[model samples]
Target: MPNDSPYKAALQKLFRTRLVARLDDLRQALKRQSRTTILHALRAVGYLTSYSHAGRYYTLERIPQFDPKGLWRYRQIGFSSRGTLRATLIHLVETSPAGQTHTELQDLLHLRVHDTLRLLVRARELQRKPFQDTYVYLSAKPKPASRQWAERQKLAPPPAPKERNLARVIDILVDLLHHPEDDARAVCQRLRAGGHPVTRAQIETIWAHYHLKKTPHVRSRHGRL
Candidate 1:
């Protein structure tokens, strides 16, 4: 279709008013029976198909305000500058510094991507490895995947102690008797200051085992205990 086509003008006006429309809506606005004709009109006006809803929707290219991830959503329908969800996932995993976990990707994309991730892994388009209790997806490229894995290790929290250290537990209890108001973190800090190698996890373990609660100590104003 030419740039001066009436159907193109109609499509532009329809998109400007609705922001997003279905293929049927496009056909109706274009007054064209053929899907090819409608697509030509849409392309002539510069358009994007929704990445979500099985790609059932369309919008003008200029309508989307894509985020850092190159994604935008209209009334719960998603669109991506990267084109499809599969392509978007590959880009996100490849570009991420520490790679991404399934939960992380789901949180970012607001969609379940288990099957897609599985397929990507099988195809060797992305890689996955155990990280803590979850898997982290990385670039298929060896060097980038290695870098992402290393960075992920650097970012990970220290593993919790598998068993409570009896000496540390006693030290924490002793400190708690002196400073009854101190929470686990405060106890850890004071113990560390006192040359006791106690961690917050150990303190938490002790508290949990004994069901200890830290309550603020109060004193009478008239010098009464």
Candidate 2:
């Protein structure tokens, strides 16, 4: 089609009004029954097919205001400067300082990417490794993957202290003995009121250790539940 073609003008007008158009919409606006002609017109004007919605949507390349991640969304339909969803995921993982996790990707893309991530790993286009309880997606290259892993380690929260004070445990146990109906919070309040300085976490730990339940039943002097 020529630059002065009426079909291209009509397509541009449609895009100006709707911002995004489906292939059918483009065909209708161009007044052409041929998919090839409509697509040719779109290409001539520089168009982007959405990475989302199974590429059902299209917009002019100049229309999107891409974010720092090279992503743009129009009414939940996503467009990526990197092109398809697979390419976008690879780019994001390769560039991330600490890599990206399933949750992180899902949160950012607002789409479930479990299958895509699995496929990328299987194809060796991306790498995945265990991080905390979830897997982190990394660059396929070893050096970058190692750097991302190390950066991820630095970002991890410090481990919780494993050992509880014996005195604090005893204080919590004694308080539970007096008020069997009290839950961990109630026990902590009572112990703190009496200057025991026990935290609810410590009280809960003792309760868990003793297999104790806070119910209406009272404990006998022998300490049997």
Name the candidate that leads on lDDT.
1
User: How big is the positional error of residue 115 in model 2, measured in Å on the Cα after superposition?
Assistant: 0.8
Q: Per model, how many backbone clashes are there?
A: 0, 0
Query: Candidate 1: where are CA atoms >4 Å away?
Result: 1-4, 164-167, 173-225
Per residue, candidate 1 scores C-alpha lDDT tens digits across 80-190 of 898788899999999899999999988887888999999999999999999888899999999999999999999775444445566676788789899888777888888
Top TM-score model: 1
How high is the lDDT of residue 208 in model 2?
65
Residue pairs in collision within model 2: none
* lDDT score for candidate 2 against the true structure: 0.84
Lowest lDDT 10-mer window, candidate 1? 157-166
Q: In model 2, which regions exceed 4 Å deviation?
A: 1-4, 163-225
Clashing residue pairs, candidate 1?
A: none
Q: Tens digits of per-residue lDDT for model 2 on 117-177?
A: 9999999999998988999999999999999999998877644335567777677767777
